[model samples]
Target: MKRLRDSWLTFVKKLPRAYSGRPMAFAVLLGLSALNFCSEWPQGIPRPAWIDTYDRILPDSFGSARQLLFDHFQRWFPRVPASQPVIIVAIDDKTLAAAGQWPWPRNRLANLIDAIAAQKPLAIGLDIYMPEADQTSPDKVAGNLPASAAALAAGLRALPSHEAILARSLRAAPSVLGAAASAHATADTSTDLRSAPILVHGTDPLESVLRFDYVLASLPELQAAAHGQAMLNVALEQGTVRRVPLIMGLGNKLVPGMPVEMLRVATASPLVEVFAYPSGVQAVGVADVQVPTQPNGEIWLHFASIRATQNRYVSAVDVMQRKAGAERMRNKLVLVGLTGTGLTDIRATPLGELVPGIEVQAQVIETIFDGRFLQRPAWLKLGESLFIIAFGMLIIWYVPRTDSRLAVFIRAVPKSSAILGIALNLLLLLSCVLVFRYFGLLIDAASIFIIESVVMGSFFSTALLEDEAQKRQDAAREQVRNSGKTGAGKVFDGALARWKRIHRSSK
Candidate 1:
């Protein structure tokens, strides 16, 4: 037992000393790297209060720069030249002017649906919600009539109302109506509504989605007539809509987003399948089309910014008037929504443009069809953490050693370490941008960049302080040697030496 203890003690003594004995510059760099890593450790990890400041600040500050780089890449890259399979029927100023004011009579909208359906489009998604019956309907008009007109009112009320007319159109066509999911819950208002079945193919699907308690659904009459219903609510992060949710959980039921619902209806898929792993939702599949998404069943939309003159928008009036060619509409999914400024449906995108909400959904559908999705895989965080650790250690070891040698060889060379470190960090950032542009991979390197800067700053500061101390020591030694040649000088030197010894002892 004594021999084993002695051997262990000898091995422990041979091990390298702790960080306390290392140069202050290296120690500071090491400490800074650790702090940075802890701040960036995956969101799943529990963190201290101080780390939350970094968590909040880094993303808010760096996210804009990342978005700017993404926009630059988008502008430079050659976009896919194929025809877009999705078309947006925008209710713009022209449409509103031609078809009368906002909320045109439901009977007129019924006629519009019939005209678009004649083009043999795959499906139509109504981004507008009709939560109440048309006020101009015969029933409403009859109720407002006086007794003197009762006989005439009776005949008019007997005719099918405008609500009934629109319902008939919805039943006749492939249509998915929009509903909204709200954060606030109301009383049992959804009792009359029937939610679509959400099937989880794997275990623990509930944890993989964003949950809402209340759904502001379409009118019951419209819901009953539509082929499918979906939530039109967008999920925003920091007030920006960079991603669109494919699925969401409302009460105990999982519901499809508007675009996904339209796709399902067009494909005749009965059930929307949400594939899950222990971590979170892996993908969402409608019929044969499978879409990769983040854990919350949301996709990072690679927005194809359609400018004002981009011909992607077919004015709703043209569609209603049958002025749009059948060749342009055939087999394409149509999204009907308002793009007029009065509607306030505009959303901010990474492209720095405020586009209509329907355009965002249209882009998501386009992304799925083109198989070009922006993804940050589950493994990327781990890979980034390892990268930071490896590079940080290299700087801590390399900088101090190289600074001294470079200083001796050429004084100007030592100053270049800061520039070199910054350049390397910029290169890493550019690589991230390139990977995102060409490969659609998002790797965050902000934390790593910050740590490298700190390391380089520490190196320069430590070198300067050490250099100054060495010059002071050399001057003091020279004065002591000169003092030995004279009596009065020797007395002054003895006093100085005593004071220096006392200072050293005190330290």
Candidate 2:
């Protein structure tokens, strides 16, 4: 075992040690920055999961961390409540208990719409879709009955379909049906399902817009009767709703989101205007409201505080029962969607709240009405990338000089000096919060500082370890030489002593 240990150490000593120099470290930062910048696609195309995973380990300011950073700021400081009256009519536990099971006969839903419309709301948005017919209708229920009930089944079929009833209510009200986008879906054969006309201001952005193969629109009868249709499919990042695409592609057709369509219905705008270039979409205009968005046709969602949200909802049962008065919904955009237990319409928000999907739509409406938006335009992303790269290069140039002046030959940095890096990271995070709070500009400086700091620390740490190894080798060689000289002196002295003894004996 001892021989093996010595042999291993000797073999390792003979091997050459590569330097973790400034240039090598610089390459790491540059690669990380490039990977981050490339991962961004303003056209709403999906990137692979691993790309995001790696960026979390080593980040550029403009990559995955940007959203998380903004989320953190939002958590720390509550946004000012919006003055726009956007109310969500929630179909919660209480409503379900009163309304019986889901897929409730379409007649009940039609009644809900008529009741809300009677309140004279600005617009009515339905967050649910009926891709299939109501199986609970009278004809369908009687079809399964025994043959003896043939007369009963015939009578049931003769009655008006639950679908026609719903269609009538939709036509009477200013209603927008919410549809979901999918890669595999067959849209209903209703041309009325189409979005308002989209007018492009710049080069064609069709190729760059976020795309789905098709949409799961409402039933043909309902679609024909509804005033408008909007895609409820929003852009999700890390299971959270941060940005919402104002417009998205449905196969060859373009559709607006639920909130924007509600605005169109409310304002009676027949056209939606888009400003986009080959790079990406910039802003979307409908009616008199213009909203800034990310390159991918998405606008950042500024959520309302929980306290304020408390007043935004009225029980679905209350609306249906007429217990909640028209004053609650008058002149307001009312969004209707299910939020009951066993329902799948829940969504996560950056505020760390799990809210019904309908609430998300309502917030978007409020954001549009407030006319305050979070803008992280393409140029800002570029600026952030350039700034990080430049700062890293400056540090690469300056760190060594400063370090060398402080230490003899740029020795391993003292542990205490790490405090400065931590401080810098904290300060950057604080600055990002402030910028978002006051200027509505998001800057993820922490990602840049973290990436640079890690590279900087790694370079110095490797140097320190290798320098220690070198010192050990030199000390071992010096000891070996001194021991050999001492042994040689002993041998010479012994030989002289033996010669003197022999000479004295002979005399």
For residues 1-507, could you state the per-residue lDDT of candidate 1 as single tens digits? 999999999755433232311355456556765654554354323446876677766654445544455555555552452558788888899998898888888899889889888998889999987767789999999999999998999998899999899999999999888877777756523522344566788876675678777777767888899988988877675566777889988777788998788888899888788898877778899889889888778887776656632676899899888799878778989888888868848888766677788887888787888888888766776787677667767666654554566545545666575566567878987898788778988676666676666655666565565667679899999997886578877788799999999999999
Model 2 lDDT on a 0 to 1 scale = 0.79
lDDT, model 2, position 461: 63
Query: Which 10-residue window of candidate 1 scores lowest in summed lDDT?
Result: 13-22
Clashes of each: 0, 0
Error of 1 at 461 (Å): 2.9
What C-alpha lDDT, on a 0 to 100 scale, does residue 429 get in candidate 2?
Answer: 76
Taking the tens digit of each residue's C-alpha lDDT, what string does model 2 give over 1-507?
A: 999999999865543233335666687778877765765632343456776776677554454566777787778765676585788888888999998868678999999999999999989999998988888787888888899999999888888889988999999999999888877644453333556788888867777678877677888778889999898987788788888889998767667888878888999899888888767787888888888777678888878766677788888899989999759999989998888898846788888988888888888887787766877776776777888788888767666564465444334555545666777778877777788888888776756766688667756765676799889989999898767777778798799999999999999
**What TM-score does candidate 2 get on C-alpha atoms?**
0.83
Best candidate according to lDDT: 2
